[model samples]
Target: MVQKYQSPVRVYKFPFEMVMAAYEKRFPTCPLIPVFLGSEVLSESASADGSTHVIERSCKLSVDAPRLLKKIAGVECVFFIQKNTLSWRDRTLLIEAHNETFASRVTVLETCSYSVHPDNESWTCFEQCASLDIKSFFGFENTVEKIAMKQYTANIKRGKEVIEYYLSELMSEGITEIPRWVPPAERSSPSKAASPPAAPSSEMPAAALAHQSPRLQMVSWGPDKLDADYIERYLGRLTPMQESCLIQLRGWLQETHKVKIPKDEHILRFLRARDFHIEKAKEMLCQSLTWRKQFQVDYILETWKPPSGLEEYYAGGWHHHDREGRPLYVLRLGQMDTKGLVKALGEEALLRQVLSINEEGQKRCEENTKIFGRPITSWTCLVDLEGLNMRHLWRPGVKALLRIIEVVEANYPETLGRLLIVRAPRVFPVLWTLVSPFINENTRQKFLVYSGNNYQGSGGLIDYIDKEIIPDFLGGDCLCQVPEGGQVPKSYYLTEELENLDHIRLWAETIYQSAQVSKGAPHEIMIEIVESSSVITWDFDILKGDMVFNIFHSKRTPQAVKREVSSSVPAVNNEQLIDRSWVLGVDYSIVESPLTCREGESIQGSHITRWPGIYILQWRACGPTHARVDEVLSSLQGSAPKCKVMYYTEVLASHDFRGSMTSLESCHSRFSQISVTTTSSSQSQDGSLISR
Candidate 1:
């Protein structure tokens, strides 16, 4: 494996010309860097106008390694080739270097640059990147790799110091500044010839220019900018390649997605998530951007409002900072009634609250970054699962939990720095087993679970959290403000009428479809499942009358059979299913038994496919009052009973859903005073087998 290192940009409060002059003093030999033995120029060239200079040299350095390893390698000093390109007019210097001693067994390459700051012409900026690739190292590849990385990082940190040392030496000798290069044509020849050499004055060095005899205003950096100094001071250090990835990705977004570009920290997280793979990070970032736009999630913090009941029973709130300065969130999952919360506030409301929490987390991260004087992009969540029981594992509640997880993992990748689960009861494992598959592996790795009093000792909560801020309920000094998760009163639930309005609002604001299924001709949706073992989840609610739902599979592909266009409704015409040439047993079979759904009752379910083929979901209206021929005739002629269904379906790959929550399907329904039943048909052995 190859190892790489990147250094954050460092700034010098001096002119580029003066910095370059100081940089040159380090060549030949430097006592400060004992490893840098010396360098001899191999070739040198200058532009016609003397504005650009290029120099190449053969450099030698003493390898700092264990004596035994050095003896095994039979080498004491390593050679490297260095190339320097200086553009005097542009005030920039580029340096490239590569190792020569281990040309065949190992390869090390490094690049560095010094240039004038973009916003301040007087200041200079320096950046560096290096990589080491070792193919064979006499069975000590790991040792060599580690040694190489340590050396590289050490050199990077000392680089800025070495330059500063040279600058100080020059200031001590009164060579505080160097005149800028000027072409012969640009100089005033007569005035230059008549000018007299002035005597040097005993003045303070340029470093003290910002202060007067007493004192003046300090040269403080503005918060809005992310220059070299700002990055080194606030954001954590990044490797050169990592910096390159950030710069390139940010540039790409600026060119392609000008208006909705994400913050630099946001982009950096994605790059880290993919180990700085530029293309993979870019792709993931773009998808997240699209998801955010489609769902209008960017404004969730400003738009979403939690129901009143949730505030008192949610059992979650922001707490004090963790050991690493990450914002802390305390969630008392055990005390809170998951099922009750879902009942009082619909799935959408619950999801919105979660999103709002995430948005607020992002905001808090920014504030903490300033307060803590470091980058703190992700928050730590301490989940208290002491009272967790089987009720928290209700299927609907679990499904809701999975849905929220999926959406968060997609949009808020890497926002969770750590997850501390305390007092995890026995039932917690069951819940973990059910929802862990839906969580990202990277996220799962962050979870730290504790069974009981074990969390109070070494290698527990105290390792990451300060004991002073620990909740009093958990044997700490501070009193926590988070609610105690409790059962929400059933009476607080809205009436059926108001609940129906919420469901209607969901359908009205989304792309999900609503279709009316009449008697005799059932409404069927055909989906082509190309892979077997995948999950197909469906959620639908009967808005008006009752209906029957059934799923069937067919190996034979359906041919396009067009019929007279209906002016009222358009649907796929599948009348050919009854053709004599089509065999029910061999071509198609019912995969699920007909299930009756009453009006006002929401239904959500999933099926695992056993075979790769096309599947059909059908819904038909069926009223219960068909006792005799007279009643049947009257019902058929009166209004041709119809059922309204609003539904959404999704197909997810098995691997994606493994150890993670699959996409959940949920519905909201309110029924009137109508009873319904599915029509009974002859039970076929094939249908029974498929259904099983």
Candidate 2:
């Protein structure tokens, strides 16, 4: 496997010319970076006008590796060829380097650039990216890759420090600026004729000089890139590698999801939750994004208004801040009647109430971060269980709680800094036992439990909460305003029929629809397009086995098929719109090339319609193209392969297509002509049509 690393933009509060001068200081030898022994210039050149310079050097570095592995490799030092291209006219420097030792077995390539910051002309921005590919290393490929990457990351971290050191040295020597290069014709004096302009003192004031530090100001390079100072200030301290993963993931989302991408703080939470594993975090984040869009969770804060009954009986509300500035929430679970809420409002309303709390918690976190002047990404929750009993263990109520927990765990990972449980009764463990399995292990670690009066002791809630702000119900002097829930009246209980109807209504509120695809059974939907040149856009996620997605168009409408509603999985829509008797070219024609989607992959693409007709989007289970008839029959008798897809489709008229289809335009756009040759041979094979 090849390893790639990308560094966030590190800004230096100096002009590009001054930054270039400091960077040149690291070429010969720098004690700051001990591994950087020295470099010898191989070639040098300059343009006639002295506005462009190019240099190639051979650099020597000591390899910090295990002695045993070093002996096996028989090398004490590694050599790299560095090529520098400086364009004074454009105010940019591009550095490219590659390893010369064991080039055939192990390949390492690095690229670095320094340019003026987009928003600030006086500031310089530095960015780097590198890749390490080790094919064969004498049976020590893994060890070699690990050592090389470790050393590389260590060097990356030191790069800013080294530049800052040189910048300080120049400042101490009273050289605060370097004159920019000029054309030969424009220079009048002999002193200004040098190819690389000499450093000159601007006699800058002490206060002005103090502002030159990179940490003094936060630079905004817009959404395309993250500034190192901005990351530290808003997202907390992250190692160089973690920053790389965040930058890479954020860039991928920006490229794939052009609009409605989550905030940087939100993306970083997912990265931290996955331990900086880029691929795993990307998958988790994508799923959450899909869920948020499906339910419009992003707008829940503004759209959700708690019912008056829930307002008085929910037993959960935001309190003051914790010691570390995290927003504190108090949930009087013991006093609240869970069964009453479930009976009165149904599971869906209860879920909506819980979700609104989470949304409110996140909003408060952002507000407190500004108030506290720190990175406050998560909140604290204090649960008081003084009035606990066996009535709270009702099965339907517990079931509703579990569903809420699942939704929060999947969508709100790493958003709970601490969970303080006080006055825990014996039945608390029973409740925990029923729901603990559904909670994530990372979240479970944040639980801090105290039984009975232990919460008022020295090593209890006081350690995390301020004495002045602790709720009075928890034995503190402060008065608690959270609702003291009681048993709801039986008159408020919802009738069984009304409760079932409300549950289904709330469950079907999502915009995305899911379907199951089995062998010889393809799930498809049809869109009637009356105007030519309109755009058909679709976004879908493969939740299970592999499947092929294709777009087809036909002038005649296919017979409508009734949706087979499964009792076990009511959310799944098992309906096929393409008729089995229809021929491929005779009845319908494939518009776009078939795309095979794998499990856990999110696909968004659009096709511009050439002619007006009914367009069918089909998702068929993927299988062998040339299986024998007996094999197919045997497979049907056994467990057939199944695939699940969650999808949403939209049609934009020609006038609105360009403005609305930005996110899907970059996706697969291989538009094939509606000709017989474009049809796939596999479409005519057995098991290709929807099974009756």
Candidate 3:
């Protein structure tokens, strides 16, 4: 595999002419760059008016590598051919280099440029890109690549300091600036008539500087013009490699995507999500971009409008700034009727509302970045869950919330800077249990949950938000305009016909599967739980009939049912299911109490798995049944049992599931697309489930 690097445009607070003079001082022999032994001029050229000068040299550099590798390569030094084109008229210097040593086994190409900043004439901009390809390194390709990249990154860092060193040296010598080259005819008469300075004894032959290359036109960057200053000011400070990833990904999007590329802040989120792995981040970003375009999400904020019902009853709105100037959003979730809202507007409307909030949040982040004179790319949310209870734990509503959380987490990584859950009630645990698996661990770490008067003390909301800006309900002075969340009347719910129409939209956004369970034949999902204390979560709706939901753990594996891995969820595979013949209590035991869900009711809950074994999630028709499977199977031949359900299940580890974000496969509705693996640290796991 070939490796590549591209640096963001770096700005120097000096004129291009002055910078170029500093740059020239490093050539031939510079003690500042010890590895750069020396260079022999292969060729040199200049424009007729002396506005352009081109020099080609064969450079020799000491190889910074292990003695064993050096002995194998049979060389202590490496040779490279460098080409430098200096355009005095345009105030630009372009350098291209390629290695000559080990040409048959490896190839390295680098390009560097120093030019006048487009928007500022007094400053210079520098950009660098390089690629290393090892075609046939004998048994050391990976080691060689790692060493090469480390060296390249180190050199890049030193390159800046080297230029600064030369710049300072020139300033000390009173050669702070050099006059820009001009045509002879344009020069003043006295200057033109002045005697020409004698060339240095070490200067290259004049004949070598006779040839001319074409004028070097600076390639304009894309529509989303990003510069060093802009990146630092708005996108925060990224490491050199991270900056390269952002630039490369943005350039790829600009080339392939016709629509407006996401802003730097948006791109940075995806980059951070993938931990600055350029290719991985690019893959994720492309998917998100496609999703945005497919859904016309760019126009969501402009096209979406809240219904009067939501405007009056929804418990969330933008409040004042947080202590860090993050746009503050207050959500009184416990007091709000999530079930009522879902019934009235259906899942689709609520989803759109959530997306709109995210969009507004991004805009607010940008506004605050300027207002605070720093990067503020995400918002802080204050969730007051004082009145949360069983009523809020409506199954379908919880499912809707999980679906929304999934969508937001996927498309809006790193958007929630902090979460302040104050006045958290006992029922909050139930709600958290159902939803926390879908939340990123990074985001979860930002959660500051406060119960009762715990938030009024020293380590509470005041630490994050100013006391004066706290909402009135929280016993603060501010009169928050956010609605006082209340239950929406059942009468306001849309007709069943309207809800069905909205379900189509909701279905497309989720990764759930549906299955029908008959009385004699229960639909059982077999999950191989390899980690004790992990949480098994489920969300299901009794679409056509009543059903009983039960969770069981069996020492005996069930029959191997081929697991159908879905594409959207990456990590699933066709693994063998646990074997059958597992007797209750003897080989298997019920871990959760059986809950009978009525027809048209939605259910969401989770269980803490106590043992590492095959766990079965079974949904059966809610009615009288035989005591044994043989008795139930024996009666199935005479009559057909009817029942149906749609459910989704997820196996969440108590600790962080290493590579789970990149590898896990998931689905929605009946069969969950969760593909949990058992390879992770136990200390990072959160085993409990909660709902509010």
Per-candidate clash tally: 14, 0, 39
lDDT of 1 at 2: 38
TM-score top scorer? 2
**Per-residue accuracy of model 2 over 1-692 as CA lDDT, tens digit each:** 54667778899999998787787676556677676666777888888777787878777777678888879989877777877788888898887777778777766666777899999999999887766667677897766666665656656767788788888888898989777777778788887564565321111011110110111111122258888998888889988888888888887776556555789889998998899998889889988987887787888888878777888888888888999999999999999889989888889988888888888888898888888888899999999888999999999989988999999888888999999999999998899999999998999999999997988868999999999988877768888888888888888889989888877877678878887776666777889988766767677777778888877887678775544334543444655666666778888877765777767666765666667779888888885422333443344344676688888888877577455333333332332122333223222211111100
Query: TM-scores of the models, in the given order?
Result: 0.58, 0.83, 0.66
Q: What is the C-alpha lDDT profile of model 3 across 1-692, one tens digit per residue?
A: 54566777788999987777776677667776777777787887776767677878877777777889778778888777778777777777778777677777776776777888888898999887666667766677777766766666656656778789988999999886666666677768854543221111111111111011111122335555467678889888877667777887787666544245678789899989889887788767765764675466888898878888888779999998999999999999988999899889888888889999999999999999989999998999999998889988889988888999989988999999999998888888888988999999989999989998889868888888888898998999999999997979988898988887886764365435566555555667788888776767776655556787767677786774433334643222222222345456797776655666665444555555667878877777776532244444333333455566666688887565554422222212232211232223323432222120
**Model 2 ranges off by over 4 Å:** 189-195, 198-223, 500-502, 517-522, 529-551, 560-586, 589-613, 619-643, 650-692
User: Where does candidate 3 stray beyond 4 Å?
Assistant: 27-32, 43-52, 65-77, 184-225, 505-692
Tens-place lDDT digits, model 1, residues 1-692 = 43444445678999987787677677566776787776777888878867788878777777778898889989888777778888877888887776677677776666677889887999999866555667677888777766665555445556678789988988999987677767757777846632211211111111111000111112112123245555545557775446556766666665444445788888888888788887788777876765565456887787667879999889999999899999999999999988888888777778888988999998899899999888898999999998899988899789889999998987788899999999999998799999999988999999999997999978998999998998888888899999887889998776767665754664245444666655554556777887765667776656667788777787777652223344544442322122235566687776776677766444556665666778877776784311233332333334665567766777766566563322221111121111121112111111111110
- Higher lDDT: candidate 2 or 3? 2
Estimate every model's Cα lDDT from 0 to 1.
0.68, 0.74, 0.70
List candidate 1 segments past 4 Å from native.
1-8, 30-90, 94-112, 127-158, 172-174, 182-228, 453-468, 472-479, 491-692
Of 1 and 2, the candidate ahead on TM-score is: 2
Per-residue lDDT, model 1, residue 106, is 73
lDDT of candidate 3 at residue 691, scale 0 to 100: 21
- In TM-score terms, candidate 2 sits at 0.83
